[model samples]
Target: MTLRRRILILATAVVLLGAVGVFAVLRASSRAAEKDRAQDGGPRVTRGEVALAPGDGGRRIVFRNMAWGPHRDELATVAADVPEGPRTASGVNCLRFHSAAGTGICLRADRGGVAESHRAVVLDAHLEERSSHPLAGIPTRARVSPGGRLAAWTVFVGGDSYAGTNFSTRTSILDLRTGRLDASLEDFAIRKDGKEYRNADVNFWGVTFAADERTFYATLATDGKTHLVRGDVVERTVTTLRENLECPSLSPDGTRLVFKKRVPGLPAEAPWRLFALDLASMRETPLAEERSVDDQVVWSDDRTVVYSLPGDFGADLYALPADGGGVPKRLMPSALAPAFLD
Candidate 1:
């Protein structure tokens, strides 16, 4: 072909690609605008003061509201007793959130740039921003210490899900009182089977803080297996407690842990089942929830646990008996990452 004809062909191809890109952007914009509009038959949401502190209403359940409306993805609250009632939106948006003793950790996304970014924001009792730190990847799990002096969060630095063998996660713990941050838990020393351990593929995520400020529990994945690791903030070490458990949420009384156990013979897509492990006895009891639960459960009380499941809008909260006997009940619709204030 002639040089002029070749140049013309290249120009035509560039124009076609530009048009396709514009179409994709327009489609995405349209979908986002649709989310801003209130969906018919959805729960009522109103802008209101949503304090992290427990008020006269007794106890409140703060969660990431997933209902379709103007307040979608905002940190909202409801009476702990009546979780399915009207939501009070705090105007603070978060992809993942958790709170304890009036302090909150909110993992939020920044959508303004060409590539999306995430950050962990510390919030005061009044739902106001206290501090923010940039996160390396997509946020997943977040938790605050029982006394509210420490905050922990986990993000997916690679791959799509925790179940994937090639996935990588970065778990960070922040000292709220001193403003100190542990950017990655991998920096801490690892002790497996009473021996010091190290590996290039080691990844950590799904942290749950104990009442004691120095102690915590998290999932450490290495060598195609996940373990429940007991970590010490002061010692800067993590000791493996048990294997095949992920996302362990300790009970308020600190006697047991409710975690997702990868049960054999289950489908790979949904391999986890809720199980309660007695810390003292080293015994595991499978919870009644038949479906797979892929969340770091929140202990609603000593006897009950709450977790999120895929729902119509996005995700819904479900409560189950800690004893592994009672059936799972829908706690609330269009809610995720619940933190109870009492």
Candidate 2:
């Protein structure tokens, strides 16, 4: 071969080799980082506390699915925080809040990626908050401690509204210790609208406490902008943890968090696809995924995630494997979201 030709061929081979090397390095780096994140994050859950309810009437804005089974015919106030209206239920995913006190909160609004406005209503096991706070108009959802002393709500401040909820909303924590809905902006991170934030968003939906009551978990939404801000009951200093997701439901043991995942493409209706994230490392794992999923979910021990799935004409309740979904077991098969009472 001519010397010039040989030189050209050799140079071409070296360039190709360099490109391949760079691609290999990038791939390996991504994998290594993911592995480290998972390792440091630990397991998705240690244990979960789940209640059983049939999936029947959760299709509407209101629902009932603790035990009634096929009899889950009546729909009343589930918990504090669902908007007080005629109620609504779409053909897609619905969010239901199940309290530790056998209370369930249901409302029909798209919250996965959009902000919403709602007439905040607080419901005790007896549904008394409805009459008490007849004038309240801030938060749409909240969590009260097992002792019933602490409660938190998600509310709004500016703009018109989002998903039937107030746009430019803020999260506020209520000290039910005084037995009133005082205007205290305790748990909110900040407010952003579809216009200001463009694509970034943050939402607080539910709050839960540890067995000790020292530290608790709050569910939140920010896509890639925020984590449910954690407040130390003792320190009184709120801190932000994790990067995505919200509405953290602690395992009965209080060691793990079974929260909702708000990925990059989830619509407002299908916000949470049922995922788990470690509170320690903040690494995530998918307990469920990409299909029909209910945002109102809690753990029935460490191995099961009880949630509701909307069907053709109605909603059905089903439990997915906490470790990883195996063949899903349909509880009320026709229900929406279920909360175990026992």
Per-candidate TM vs. native?
A: 0.88, 0.53
Off by over 4 Å in 2: 1-97, 101-131, 134-142, 155-166, 170-172, 180-203, 219-224, 233-236, 264-272, 292-294, 312-314, 333-337
Cα lDDT of model 1 by residue, 1-342, tens digit:
999999999999999999999999999988765664448565678788999987888888999999988899999988888888778888999999999998999999999979999999999999889999999999999999999999999999888887667678999999998998999999999999999999998999889888988899999999988999999998899999999999999999999999999999999889999999999999999999999999999999999999999999989899999998989999998899999898
Which window of ten consecutive residues has the lowest lDDT sum in model 2? Answer: 43-52
Report the lDDT tens digits of candidate 2 across residue range 1-342.
Answer: 999999999999999999999999999988654442212232111111122232343322233422222222233323212222222222122233434453333332434546553433444453333222221244334454544455555544554333333355455444444544434334323323312232345454456767664566664445534466565555544456655555677777555677666555667755556677666776667875556353446565567766656643365556677665576766443344344443
Question: Per-model C-alpha lDDT, please?
Answer: 0.91, 0.48
Give the number of the best model, judged by TM-score: 1
Error of 1 at 25 (Å): 38
Which residue pairs collide in model 1, if any? none
